[model samples]
Target: MERTGTTRRRALIGAGAAVTAALSGCSSDEPGARRDAPPSVSAETLLRRRSAALSSALLGRYDAVLAAHPGLAPRLAPLRAQVALHVEALSPTGDRPRPASSPSSSSSSAGAAASPSPSSSASPSAAVPADAGAAVRELASAERSTAAAHTAALTGAPPEYARLLASVAAAGAVHVYLLTKGSR
Candidate 1:
């Protein structure tokens, strides 16, 4: 088992190391450039803005579904409120919410608080299906897409923001399962 012949994994790892070393040294020609370090301030702000926008869009989708089919409000409102919290959390100036309560308690409280109001007046950017089950399926589809977008955004996000996005994305996936299961 001690043979010294080159293996595919070893060769690939060696090539990867060589590539990493080459890339790590590719700093800007400017005098103050830091090798292997990306600029964080502006990038972080942009990431926050983009994440907030995604949450807001998803929030709007929730609103659209509610406006089209008000009967679904009891089930959808809690999820919509969660998306609103995501918008706030992702804002550049917004402070993250404290996780003081257990997830079940917090969700139940949001559900109680968001009980179907006749005046939830957010305009729907996209048409919602008239059928209630179809509308639930549409929301599930939106949740899946939004979760993917949030997960994709984690590539270069700061660790704190990345953690938040990951949690939100996980919630979105759960929302998908709940919506689909309930619709059936």
Candidate 2:
């Protein structure tokens, strides 16, 4: 039997949507599930999930900064790539949805909107203090602070994540130097 092109496409789309819905439902902790249903996952799984979410959030912020300051692109390209690699490596672990009460959740949308698109070539303005340096230092500092959270994420996260955190930390330190020097 020959199916019409529209019918075939609609069938495929319906099947895909059903599969996505099923996966999304299964991924969440069910309300009726026992508090101790074999814990559903090991400590490593929890750690990996949390770490992946944190890493994704941090990288998202950095991507925004790089977007805003075009001049930093040449210098930050490698670090951004590393963050991307880290995000991909940890992506199998899904993001943990932020609770309404979480302080970070409140600012999340604002941060996302504030991130620059990289096409705009905005420089550090004279409005800021002399010691503040260029936008890169500020960006590096943000990465460093987030790296510390990644370190905290390591407490219960997989052992491998510790190494990733270390790499990010080191990269952030290098970013600080490069940004400062570039600003001079």
Candidate 3:
């Protein structure tokens, strides 16, 4: 009669086969990916670029408020400087920002912010409320919006980038408090 129970030879053979299959799965699938298209950017690059752009737009908004109401300078100077630093920090290594006519679209950034040239100066936007109190509120709204965006981005950012976002978001919160204080 044939033995029905599994022999050592059979068990060893099955284990060897299983390990081979598992290892095959572990090896990289080298040939299946398409490589013909332009290389895509890494997630870090995209995140940094977006953060820098946000800061740049905020800087332009500050410029607009200052242009529209120069009297607010003493109140806004330090905050604007902080924002300019944020822009610098968020920008990729070696990239210098230039004063831009259109911060959202313009690709340049600065080491020391370039004086906004005549053509590039943020005009006294009609959107700026004439009342300084109202204008401060408007600026506060912008700070709140940008801070929220930075906070939202934290989940996806790498460790270092997330830290930067967190700090900037915190600073924005403080700016909101400063601007709204006493004006309330």
> Which candidate wins on lDDT?
3
RMSD in Å for model 3: 6.8
Residue-pair clashes, model 3: 5
Tell how far residue 34 is off in model 3, in angstroms: 7.9
Per-residue C-alpha lDDT of model 3 across residues 1-184, encoded as one tens digit per residue: 8889899999999999999999887765647645575777878778888887777777777777787889888788778878877877777664545554555542223312532222333445536787888888988998999999999999999999999999999999999999998334
Selected candidate, larger TM-score, 1 vs 3? 3
What is residue 9's positional error in candidate 1, in angstroms? Answer: 45
Against the true structure, whose TM-score is highest? 3
lDDT of 1 at 153: 95
Please identify model 1 stretches exceeding 4 Å from their true place.
1-41, 94-125, 182-184
Q: TM per model?
A: 0.62, 0.49, 0.66
Predict model 3's lDDT versus the native: 0.76
RMSD of each: 11.1, 19.4, 6.8
The number of clashing residue pairs in model 2 is 1
- Taking the tens digit of each residue's C-alpha lDDT, what string does model 1 give over 6-75? 9999999999999988887784765788677875678888888787777767777787787788888778
TM-score of decoy 2 = 0.49
List model 2 lDDT by residue over 43-69, tens digit each.
676666665565566566555566566
Q: Local error of candidate 1 at 179, Å?
A: 0.8
Which pairs of residues collide in candidate 3? 96-109, 96-110, 97-109, 97-110, 98-109
Per-residue error (Å), model 3, residue 25: 16
